[model samples]
Target: MHLIIMRHGEAGWHTNDQQRELTETGRRDVADVAAHLAESPYRPRAIWCSPLLRAQQTAAIVAEVINCPIEEKSFITPDDDPGLCLDALLEQPPASPLLIVSHMPLVGALATLLVDAHRRGLPFMPGEAVVLDMPVVGPGCADMKTQFLP
Candidate 1:
C-alpha cells in the first residue's frame, strides 16, 4: 500500500480549533500541490481526512484535482494517537493509494512511526505530503518514497 500523509494547509486562528479555515495562501498552496499530484505517479485514488475544517478544505482541493472521494476520519485529529491511526489504516481494504489530510503533530508522528518505528515526528510544512510504500503495515515496515512540497 502507498500511504500519502499530508499536513493541512495554513489556517487562520479561531477560538475553536476545529472551526479554523484555510487562508487564501493555504488554498492556493494546496491547489498547487494537488495539481502537481495530478501529473505524478503518487496521485491518490481517495482521501482520508481529519474532521477539522482546514483538513476537510485541503482534502477537497486535492480531491478536485485527483478526482477522488474523501472520507472524514475522527482518529486522525491533531492529538489522535499514531498507533490507533495505524490500526485504522490496517483495517482498510487494500486497493488504491490513499491520501491522508491531517494536522501537524499527528501527520508527522504517524509518518515517523510507520517509517522509523518511533513516535518522534518528521517536520512537515503546510500542504506538504510524504509518500510511503509499504507492503505490510507495521512499525518500520514502510519506506519513504518522496515528498510533495507546495
Candidate 2:
C-alpha cells in the first residue's frame, strides 16, 4: 500500500483551531504541488482528509486537480493518535494509493510511526507531503519513497 501523507497548507489564525482556513499563499502553494502531483506517477486515487477546515480546504484543492474523491476522517485531527489512524487505514481498500490531508503533529507523528516504529513527530512544513510504501500496514513496515514540498 502507498500512503501519501500531507500536512495542510498554511492557515490564518482563528479562535478555534478547527475553524482555521487556508491563506492565499497556502492555496497557491497547494495548487502548484497538486498540479505537479497530477502529472507525476505518485498521484493519489483517493484522499482522506481531516474534518478541520484547513485540511478540508487542502484536500479540496488536491481533489480538484487530481479528480479524486475525498473522505473526511475524524481520526486524523492534530491531536488524534497515529496508532488509531494506522488501524483505520487498515480498514480501507488498498486498490490504489491514498492521500491523507491532516494537521501538523498528527501528520508528522504518523509518518514516523509508519517508517521508524516511533511516534516522534517529524518536522513538516505547510503543504509538505511524503510518500510511504508498505507491504503491510504496521509499525516500521513502510519505506519512504518520495517527498513533496509546496
Please give, for residues 1-150, the per-residue lDDT of candidate 2 as tens digits.
889999999999955886999999999999988988888788999999999999999999999999999999899999999999999878766546899999989999999999999999899999998989998999999999998998
Candidate 2 at residue 140, lDDT? 96
Please give, for residues 63-149, the per-residue lDDT of candidate 1 as tens digits: 998899999989999999999888987886644688999998999999999999999999999999989998999999999998999
lDDT of every model, 2 decimals: 0.91, 0.91
Off by over 4 Å in 1: none
- Consecutive 10-residue window with the lowest summed lDDT within model 1: 88-97
TM-score on alpha carbons, each prediction: 0.96, 0.96
